[model samples]
Target: MIHVLFVCTGNTCRSPMAAALFNHWAEVMGMSSRVRAGSAGMAALGGEAASEHAVKAMARRGINLAHHRARPVEEAIPKADLVLCMGHGQAQLLRERYPRFAERIHPLMPYAWGLRTDVEDPYGGDLETYEAVAEKLEETVQSVLQKLENSRET
Candidate 1:
């Protein structure tokens, strides 16, 4: 199985949301057996639950983030076949820290959509803000799924 890891600052918002969305879509597309996703934070205190807004926003999309527990980046990186970060800075930092996995580490937007942008963090944002982030993540996740599919065909 191909393990995709989503990384963010705190794992309370963006990364977990992205992971849940990716897993949901992967299963929907019948790729769950071939690929799976997990999430972690660059500096997270392990065990914190996903943010309230994140859980609510995901619920809107029929995806659940209520059970997500924060994890440290180091714990997850070694297992990731591909590590997609929320921004360029995170990607750069991760590459520096885990040089052996540098080739597999990339910023999500540019890698998935060719956009030089960061996935906005909605840590303390309102529900609307969380929703917008979720929409962006959904788009990014769709692109990721397509790329995974294409890779499989080759």
Candidate 2:
């Protein structure tokens, strides 16, 4: 099994969106059995529900994060096979904070989406902004799952 943990600043926007989308993608690709996806944050407070915009954005994709509660990276680090951070800074922070897991930590956009950029947070952004972020997350998640699926063959 492959466990992917998506990380962001607060776990209320980007990471939650990415993780839910990743799970949807896995289900669509018939790879749900082999892939596990979740989200956390660098500075998140525990038990906070996903942002309303995040919930709405996911509803548009038929995925739900209405019940997703924020978790700190510590709770997620030990279980993740791959740690996909929303930006280079987040990845760098993880590398510094937990050097032992450095090898598995990576920037989500550049590595998964080939954007050479970051997935910006839409924490207090409008619905349109959240929708756009969701779209990008879906795109990246597809690529990530595809790469993981391919890797299993070797």
Candidate 3:
């Protein structure tokens, strides 16, 4: 199994969004049995649930974030084949903190869609902002699935 870990400032938002979206992508591509995903935070309030807006946003896509609980970044790397971070800063931090895993750490958006940008945090944002973030995540996830699927065909 290839395990992917999504990282963000707090596990309440972006990372969980990426994890949930990745799982959906895995299902759509029939790779659910091989590719698995989870999320963690750089500075986390462990055990806290995902943000309300995040939960609702995922609900719109028929994904569930309700069971998500915050975890710290330190506990993530060892189990992950790839560690995707929400922002460049977070990716940098992971590389600095876990230098041995540097090659496996990358910014989620750029790694997913060749877009060198962060998945902006929407923790305190309104529902519309969460909706927009969800859309962006879905697009990125779809792009990643296409890339991986195409690669497998070759």
- Model 1 misplacement above 4 A: none
What TM-score would candidate 2 get against the native? 0.97
lDDT ranking from best candidate downward? 1, 2, 3
The lDDT of each candidate is 0.95, 0.91, 0.89
Best by TM-score: 1
Q: Write the per-residue lDDT of candidate 2 for residues 1-154, one digit (tens) a residue.
A: 8899999999999999999999998999999999989999999999989999999999988887888999999999999989999999999989999999999999998887667899878877899999998888898899998889888888
- State the weakest 10-residue window (summed lDDT) of model 3: 143-152
Q: Candidate 3: lDDT over CA atoms?
A: 0.89
The model with the greatest lDDT is: 1
CA error at residue 85 for candidate 1, angstroms: 0.1
Better of 1 and 3 by lDDT: 1
Report the lDDT tens digits of candidate 1 across residue range 1-154. 9999999999999999999999999999999999999999999999999999999999999987888999999999999999999999999999999999999999999999999999988888899999999999998998998899999999
What lDDT is reached at residue 140 by model 2? Answer: 83
Residue 41's lDDT within candidate 3 is 97
The TM-scores of all predictions, comma-separated, are 0.99, 0.97, 0.95
